[model samples]
Target chain A: MLATVDQHDDTSPEIGGIAVDRLRSIIERVERLEEERKALSGDIKDIFAEAKSAGFDVRTIKQILKLRRLEPSAIEEQETLLDIYRRALGM
Target chain B: MLATVDQHDDTSPEIGGIAVDRLRSIIERVERLEEERKALSGDIKDIFAEAKSAGFDVRTIKQILKLRRLEPSAIEEQETLLDIYRRALGM
Candidate 1:
């Protein structure tokens, strides 16, 4: 017997024998996290504005942040590709 | 004369001697990338839905994604702390 197919709750679907309340709770938790994520993104934009006002190159800072998130080997591979592209472009 | 202070373009502010057009271009590029990121997040959510329909544990998959993004030492440290917490709770 598939619990989800029984469809007792219209709003929340159950999986296995999991209750509708549990599924709704999971959805609510994900929704709350998403709200927090959006707020954090706005905070990040404010920090970028602060950095720009301080004469920092926000674009370069963003690039550095992306590179730092990657492993060293991945960064090396990206640099190699970048160098190749630069040479091909006669830069 | 600070290029940003002169405020030639009301929409886009310049930094140093950089043109307002160039600054606006950078901002537009970031905005475009953010749009793509949102689309990718939607795609990821769809994948999670598929996984759940197939009876897979979405939470464990998310945890695996997070652990894979971290360095080995960071994961180990996290696991160590998790174990300590579990033991404290008599798990």
Candidate 2:
């Protein structure tokens, strides 16, 4: 795969000279990163399944993901809600 | 802006007929949504500044945003850390 990438880089010089090389390098790096991302995603899915098997509230996990996407203040609001929920449960 | 958008839509009908109208509507909707997004972003940033002035750990808020981008299991890990942090601080 690396050899193929290097060969493609060599013959594709007519595309845009050095800029094409740079773009190719960036695209290759991104492709590698995407593969790593997919692997990590699968690992996370497995962990969630494990947690479900262990009887944790999976819905709370989903909520955590949703809250995590918000801005800082929004996250603080979510944390406050979590605190309230924990307190109400005497945990 | 709405008038300009409508005029553009009317003149651009040769681009693709009904599909052009549908595309124009979608683009107009997106433009409006983008304006709303900017307003909301400004509001959230102001809220964060206020929270910082109130002496909250802004890092946690940033972390929350980062975690929110992750999958469910990754979010669960972040919440576990938050739970531990809260308990340690006696909050």
Candidate 3:
């Protein structure tokens, strides 16, 4: 019930000396980014639909995109680690 | 020299049944999203600066945000896994 804005009263609780305005601004900004992220994700899904129409494997394409983001050395290192872990687990 | 847009000539190579136009569109969209993500991250950093100015631990705040994103059960499982791994490594 403390939704009162622009008040200098003790009723307005500021936890740990955090300014309510600043906290609200940060939250609003993050929410805006989250909205944009959701839109971008939808766009990505649309692209996946297009790719599927062109006979592309969506899962493989996603994997390729993720792998392309990684450095070649990093990919190699990860593969080596996976091998080691599997060996250790007797898999 | 292979940036010849709008030509159906054999000089425009299509790799592995992938449409060059579609591929370019996908890459452009991903790049745009990447740029937006970078900008959003900078905005988040600005919020961290504001928080720090208000006597908050930026690192701890970052950790709290990350932990907040995870489901409670998932976090508990991750903590259990970490403990198990640490014990296995004798750390």
Candidate 4:
């Protein structure tokens, strides 16, 4: 009954007996976080650009960034699999 | 030369003539953003928990979240492929 609308309240909207306001609040929180994510992505890109300007290889630096996110053992295992795959493909 | 260390400075360390300080700065920036990303993920999970407590299906909500992150056409195409695969598998 917490988020249930008053039946007599004509201005209020309800879906499945739940108030529209509650649903909207839940959706709006996700929307706000999505905007923040976009901004953060742009900020990260700006840092990459700075690294490039400083004579760094942005592509390699990005790869390094991703590799650093993983455990060393995981990277080594992935490398082993990748090498096997390349060899299987006769590369 | 801005981030290049003085060759005469015994305290300075460099890799391929690039200062470790510069490399550390780049790594640290990514580390900071990763922390922020983890915090944001927790916030999103909290919202999902709120929705779940309010009688919403969190698994379906998570699917909706991922679907929202993609283009409508992409989703439709993926759904088509998924349906074909499922049918082929007699599911």
Model 1 stretches with alpha carbons more than 4 Å out? A1-19, B1-91
**Which lDDT tens digits does candidate 1 get at residues B1-91?**
2224345565655556655554554455555555655764675577568657755578865675566568999999989999999999999
lDDT of 1 by residue, A1-91 (tens): 1224346566666656655554444455555555555664675587677657755588776886677568999999989999999999999
Clashes of each: 0, 2, 0, 0
lDDT score for residue A69 of model 3: 86
lDDT per residue (tens digit) for residues B1-91 in model 4: 2346678776658878776777779878977886787788789889988887887776766676788889999999999999999999999
Q: Using lDDT, rank the candidates from best to worst.
A: 4, 3, 2, 1
The weakest ten consecutive residues by lDDT in model 1 chain A span A1-10
Q: Compare the candidates by DockQ and give the number of the best one.
A: 4
Q: Tens-digit lDDT track for model 3 on B1-91? A: 1223344656546765555766666656765776676676677677767766765566765576678689999999999999999999999
lDDT tens per residue, model 2, B2-91? 222344555555432344666778999999999999999999999899989997556666755564578879666756865754455454
- For model 2, the docking class works out as incorrect
Model 4, which residues run further than 4 Å from truth?
A1-16, A84-91, B1-12, B56-91
Summarize candidate 3's per-residue lDDT along A4-81 as a digit string, tens digits: 334475555575555566555655666566667667777777877776776666776677677888999999999999
How accurately is candidate 4 docked according to DockQ?
0.19
lDDT string for model 4 (A1-91, tens) is 2457678887778878876777778877987886787777788888878877777777877788889889999999999999999999999
For A1-91, candidate 2 gives per-residue lDDT tens digits of: 1322344556555332345666778999999999999999999999999988997656666655665568869766756865654455454
Q: What docking grade does candidate 1 earn?
A: incorrect
**Better structure of 1 and 3 per TM-score:** 3
**Per-prediction DockQ:** 0.03, 0.05, 0.09, 0.19
Between candidates 1 and 2, name the one with more favorable DockQ: 2
Which regions of candidate 2 fall more than 4 Å away from where they truly are? Answer: A1-15, A19-26, A58-91, B1-12, B18-22, B54-91
Better of 2 and 3 by lDDT: 3
